[model samples]
Target: MKLGISSASVTERYGYDKGFELIKKSGFDAVDVGLEQYGVESDPFKLYHRSEDEFCTFFDTIRKLAEKWELEISQTHGRCNTYSMDKEHNAYVRWVSERDLKATSLLGAPACVIHAIVSGRFPEHYQNLEFMISKNAEMYGDLAPFAEKNNVKIAIETSGRAMVNGREIKGCFSDAPVFQKMFEAVDTRCKTVCVDTGHTNEAVPFGAPKVQELIRLLGKEITILHLHDNNGTYDQHLPPIRPSRGTVEWCEVFETLDEIGYSGVYNFELNLIQFGGVMDEAVRFLGKYLRYFIENKGKLM
Candidate 1:
């Protein structure tokens, strides 16, 4: 497994190019860039503008930087919450997602991770999930060719909220079966799973062993992984450490990945604040752990 950092952690300080540079200089193999808010200090939810040329330019610059730093642009994350609202917002979300998919292709990244809509807006939770999944597939159907041309995949991440009888439910989809159904509905090889460890923990009422189960179920279908830890109640965005009652076992997670021959980057999606203001230290911490696992990966297998 390779080590990577998600740009969301340092978006407050670094722009796309600098963020990739810092991640590379900090000894990470790759970086996950949030394409929607490139070079902006505002949240994607607060921004209403859409410029295709500007987006393309931002990705071009990122590609150049990635080449310069010898770092892989492992994945691209579109704006979260963009797809959770009305028809217009959902259209915008699809437009932006397609743009990112094209950009991901140009940058040589394999996948783009996106969030599912919340269920409360609709009458029922599973119904809403089914609708959102179908809508996403329909909206982005044209981009599959671009994905095919660019050799990239679109990864739908399991979200943290569910809807029950028009009330907001606070958990991810009950299991991998939901994801399997979505994938089957979409009926595209480009669609895959991006598992967020923190979100998986948040979805469970107790321990997050379901995360391992999901990986096992999805197996080779999992194209990307957001590797961060949480203390069960909230998304702590902590770096991988020893697992506790609430969190997942770091070593076991790696072991399972090894068993499945998952070659994707284990992108660290932790918050920089939790690292005590030292980005290098955070990178080193993750690198040490990942190196230990990679070196022992064969033995574990």
Candidate 2:
């Protein structure tokens, strides 16, 4: 797999230009442009409303810089939900989601990562798993045409089922079975899965499949990745922890990807530079390591 990093790694530190430049200098092959910088949800839509011309210019600038650095924008991420009950808010979120797809196209990325959008806090809403799956399919079906038009695919991400206010509630498509059903419901040509390692760690104890197992289960349907580490509780988004530093079994993860013939990018979604190290060396090390892992499949780290 090609090694890449998210632009979000340095957005707060250097803004877009310098941030992207740093990613390139660090030897990453691609980037994940996080449109959430504009705003998390309805805010991106609001930003565009405030100045459509400026919004377009911002992405234009990003594309030019990525070209300058020879870095590909492999994927993009922003917030959108299909299960919300509020009609007006849902409409606004949908608008932002479309803009995210357009932004992915603008950057020449092939996919855009999205959440399944069901909150664990609301048990009443998700009593029927079929309903939740159908909602996701319906929403992605609406988005697929635009995705195809933009030459992009919707990468549904696996997230953690959370405990809200002492209630153990299920998250949207947090498990392999539900995700498989959802995938079957949607137009597969325009959609795929982007597994978040950290989130997967959190989901395992809740009956969700292990990271490698999920990879083995989904196989080619898993087209993208969001690499990071967490402490087995929340989505910490920490830099890749030492193999012994966390719950994830890195060697097994690589083994499964190899077994399934994953030919995609090993895109790190963590804080690449701020975690205290030489940026270039850090990136080069990660790239080299991933290459080694791919070359030596099933060999334990």
Candidate 3:
């Protein structure tokens, strides 16, 4: 597996030009590129809403920068979910999701991480597992054409984020069995799974499968990863904790990957630089140490 991490923090500090170079220097083989839009007013969708050429230029610059640093863009994070009861708002989200696929292809990423359908402004009452599966199947079917057109696959991320409303949807496809069934329901050629360690940890207490079991369940359907550590209660996105000290069992996870023949990027969606260490050395240390811990647990630390 190739070591990878997100370009968000370093890119936030030094912008893309220096960011990719710093990441390459960190010993990472790849990155999980962030395609999330942010700005005041209606400018949030600016990237997705740009003229065709401008959109191409935007992602092209990122792809070129990664290439300049000899780094692969393993995957990208697209729009997470849609909100609001308005049909126009929902349509607008579909538009952004399509652009996400287009941008993923432009960036040379094979997969784009999007969330499963949730209880937002969506009209589907997902309290019933059958209803949730049916709704998500229809949604994936609608998105698959866009995915196929861009020659990129839409990756449905495992969510452990709790719903704020009790009267809304009760569950998502976070459980491994349910997630597997949902995968079978969708068009696999245009869809896959992105196993999120932090979220999986959060889901475990709620009766979802452990990371190892989830890996076995998803098997080859797992095409990408979001590796991070937490305290087993939430999506903390913390740096890799000492082995056997956090929610994830690094040894067991890698072992399971081996057992399942998972050939994918070890991409992190984490705050590895959160401790305020020197940025360059910190990234390097995290990258090197994470792999070392995985490869050799040092007598279980």
Better of 2 and 3 by lDDT: 3
Put down candidate 1 lDDT per residue, 1-301, tens digits, no spaces: 5778887666456665676666777678888876666423464632324465665665677788788989888898865654444778666666666666777876778888866444444444455566756755664464567666667887878655454675544543535676666666665667778888887776666322456777777788787888777776676777655444346565566777877879888787777766656865666566666556546742334
Name the regions of candidate 2 deviating beyond 4 angstroms. 39-46, 50-52, 80-82, 119-121, 169-172, 272-301
Cα error, residue 144 of model 2, in Å, equals 2.3
Worst 10 residues of 3 by lDDT: 161-170
Worst 10 residues of 1 by lDDT: 39-48
| Candidate achieving the largest lDDT | 3
**Model 2 clashing-pair count:** 0
TM-score winner: 3
Would you list the C-alpha lDDT of every candidate in the order shown? Answer: 0.67, 0.74, 0.77
Candidate 2: tens digits of C-alpha lDDT, residues 141-219: 8778888888889999886766555666446577777778888888658788898888888777777788888778888
Candidate 1 stretches with Cα past 4 Å from truth are: 15-18, 38-54, 82-85, 121-133, 139-146, 149-151, 161-174, 206-209, 243-246, 293-301
Report lDDT (Cα) of residue 183, candidate 1: 62
What's the TM-score of each model vs. the native?
A: 0.80, 0.86, 0.90
Error of 1 at 234 (Å): 2.1
Model 2 TM-score (2 dp) = 0.86
